[model samples]
Target: MSRRQSELEGRLDDMLSRIAMETQEIKELEQQLTDGQILANEVLQRDLEGIISGLQEYLRGLRDQARRSQQQVDSLQAENQSLQLHLEDSQRHCRQLEDRARTHTQDMSVQQEELSVLRTEAHALRDRQVESSRQQEELEVELQQLREELARQVTLGQLERGALLAAVDKEKQSTEIRECQLQATIDTLQDEKSSLQQITLRLQAQLDQTRTQYTETRDHLDQTRLQLDRFTAAMLDPQEVQSGPDDLDEDKYRYHYYNFIFQQDLAPAQTARSTKTWFDVHAITVLDWPANSPDLNPTENLWGILKRKMRGTRPNNKEELTASIKEIWASITPRQCHVASRQ
Candidate 1:
């Protein structure tokens, strides 16, 4: 029984030893697994760090591109502002030029109208001058004929005087009466010669005055044309253009011409005594014409026309006559006034 018990103890000790060895092998396997896990964790941490660094670099590049883009946008905005200002200035200048052009066009139109009127007046004046020249030539021819007639009359008078002297010697008694008659005829011829000489002097003076007036008129026309040309040239420059006083109207011109005729032509002949003498010569009941009456007025030529129209038309009353005269006067046109003034 002792030997059997000892063998059992020995087997137990061997079994226990085998179990310890197995436990140690199991612990080693666990340790090897833990080491592998640690290595894997470290490798994963490094990969994560590399990825984070790549992301940061990409973000920086994006930020730099955005900054460059912002600067470009600012520069473009400044250029756009400058371009807008230039466009505004261009528009303003264009408007000013248009205004100036419109003004110049209107001025040209007015000046052209005025020039046409002046040309018409010039043509009328030339026609009048030509008529005056023709009348003057006719007067000169009449004067030459009168001078030739005067020479023939002088020769006849000389021959008659010689015949009268021979007849006086033949009959003394009849000669006395005949000589007295011949002397009276000689005195009448002398008075006629003096009157003709006075008339010739007056005609010569009138001719000289007419020549002077024509020369002055031609000079005035030339000066007026020069002024118009200068004004037209000035119109080209906007800065030089200016408004001037308007020309006188036709009524104002007529008034001035009438005043001139009164002052230069009528005033000298209108003394109180001369006016009285004229009325006395006409056997007029009134001392003179009524104030502003057409009678004896140089500018009034309508009276003769009225007289001619009234011929054979006898009115029963003064009122009817006045009405007829007023109607006829109203019918007279501006053209008639111009014709009367020219005459």
Candidate 2:
């Protein structure tokens, strides 16, 4: 009985020890699983944070793009309105010019008709003078024959002689009166010719002036049309306006500069004085700019930066140039914008 009891106690200790070993193994496995799960959760959290940050940045970019689109639309609408008004005015002026041209043309036609009539009448008067002179020569020869006949027939009655002389005198007086009337007609025709020539010259001058005005108006209208066409094309596809790298380069530089100028309305009074003719021609309003300002121009600095950025890239086409420019612009940091603003 004592031997059996001791054997039973030893078996229980062995079983207990085996159970403790199994329990220790299970704890170790649970600790490894927990550690793996924690590590996975941390990695997932980091990935989600990155995704959220990227989405937020994309959303901001979209908002900014939308804002810029709206501003461009507003500016285009305003410019279109102004162009419409200018077109209407131009059309109205064209109509007035047409009316004046028509008036001048009609006046010229009337003057031409008067001139033609005067020329015909002057020619008729010259023909009549030639016929009158021939008739006068014939009458003078007949009078001389009558005087010789009278001298040869002196034995005849004195009354017959007296009658012949009286008839000759009467005929001479009639010829003199007719000559004076013809001379008066010729002088009158000469006066009309001179007046008509003066009128013709004056009308020609007016016609030339009208032609010049019409040409100028047409040119102005053509310029306006071209401007509207360019604006429409730009509205449809902004890239269409960029013909080449040089154009894009200049335009990009001007874009930043003009934006800065417009945002602060910089140098308003100075611009009015410097570009008076240009402003007056365009009829643009000059807003109030800060006074007595230093010329802190930022475009030159931006140009230098842009040139440096574009040093390595040589675009072969307009599209390539445009893409390169866009890429460079996107790469420009906020610090650059801040620096430009400060300047």
Candidate 3:
């Protein structure tokens, strides 16, 4: 770049020198013309003027060319600066490319080493494939033997299965026989159950009839007793009953007792004593009465008879006592009541 600048400067200097020399020569010629122009021909004077104009034009052209050259040099210097920057950028890019190429070369070398190792592994795998093929053939032979053995075992298994099926069939037949036996037993049990059910129904019917007869007999007995009580109470020897203020308390007690027994006065009014305590304390069937008043509440007499019977039988529990009482109560006939009433 410096050499090119120097060359351009040299050319411009040479041009300037040539222009100076030409100007000097032209000045000398002008002096000669001024000194010899009066003796010179018009042709010579015209030639001198043409020469001077030509020299002036040439000088102007040279000056213009020099100016153009200077402009061109400046342009070239700007271009050189741009090109230098571009060259530096290019150099940097080339260096990067070189670095990349070197890295690629290293990578390629490593890849080549890996490829060699892969080749060795491939060769080993190939040998292993050959060995595996041999082993596969051996295994195929073993498989054939195993298949033969398996086929034999399968035949044995089939035979065993046949035996098992036979046994299963025998077991199934035995199970069927047992089922038939069980069915027969079930039929017998069903017959027995039917007989028992018939007996139970007959017994239930008899029980119902007995309960009806008992209820009627008991109702008749109760009616008879009530009539006898009323009769006995009515036979009061025509005496005038004297009412005293103390008798009023006894009368109120009797009223409350009857009310409690009959479930009268749903929410009873509070009295001297709660009637609830009376029920908790006493049973309506059991009562305290004088000797002559025995006929007034004949249920007391029945309870006394029942208690006498219960006293002889030692019961372990209330249930047994209740059952015995219920049985004895059910056994009580109208004859028994009549006898008791007579007594």
For candidate 3, give the lDDT of residue 123: 97
- Whole-model lDDT, model 1: 0.68
Q: State which candidate has the highest lDDT.
A: 2
The residue ranges of model 1 lying beyond 4 angstroms of the native Cα positions read 1-39, 113-343
* Ranking of candidates on TM-score, top first: 3, 2, 1
Candidate 3 least-lDDT 10 residues: 244-253
User: Which digits, one per residue and each the tens of the lDDT, describe model 3 over residues 1-343?
Assistant: 4465557567766866776686567667666665456456456556866876786677677667767777988999999999999999999999999999999999999999999999999999999999999999999999999989999999999999999999999999999999999999999999999999999999999999999999999999977755554443334422312343223333223332243433222223522266656654443332333343324345655776788788889889989988999988887776767666666
Q: Candidate 2 on 58-142: residue-level lDDT in tens?
A: 6566556656666877899999999999999999999999999999999999999999999999999999999999999999999
Candidate maximizing TM-score: 3
Deviation (Å) of 282 in candidate 1: 99
* lDDT of candidate model 2 versus the reference: 0.72
The per-prediction tally of clashing pairs is 0, 0, 0
Candidate 2 TM-score, C-alpha based:
0.23
Among all windows of 10 consecutive residues in model 2, the one with the lowest summed lDDT is 252-261
Q: Which model is ahead, 1 or 2, in terms of lDDT? A: 2
Candidate 2 error regions (>4 Å): 1-169, 244-343
TM-score of each: 0.23, 0.23, 0.34
Candidate 3 regions with alpha-carbon error over 4 angstroms: 1-124, 221-343
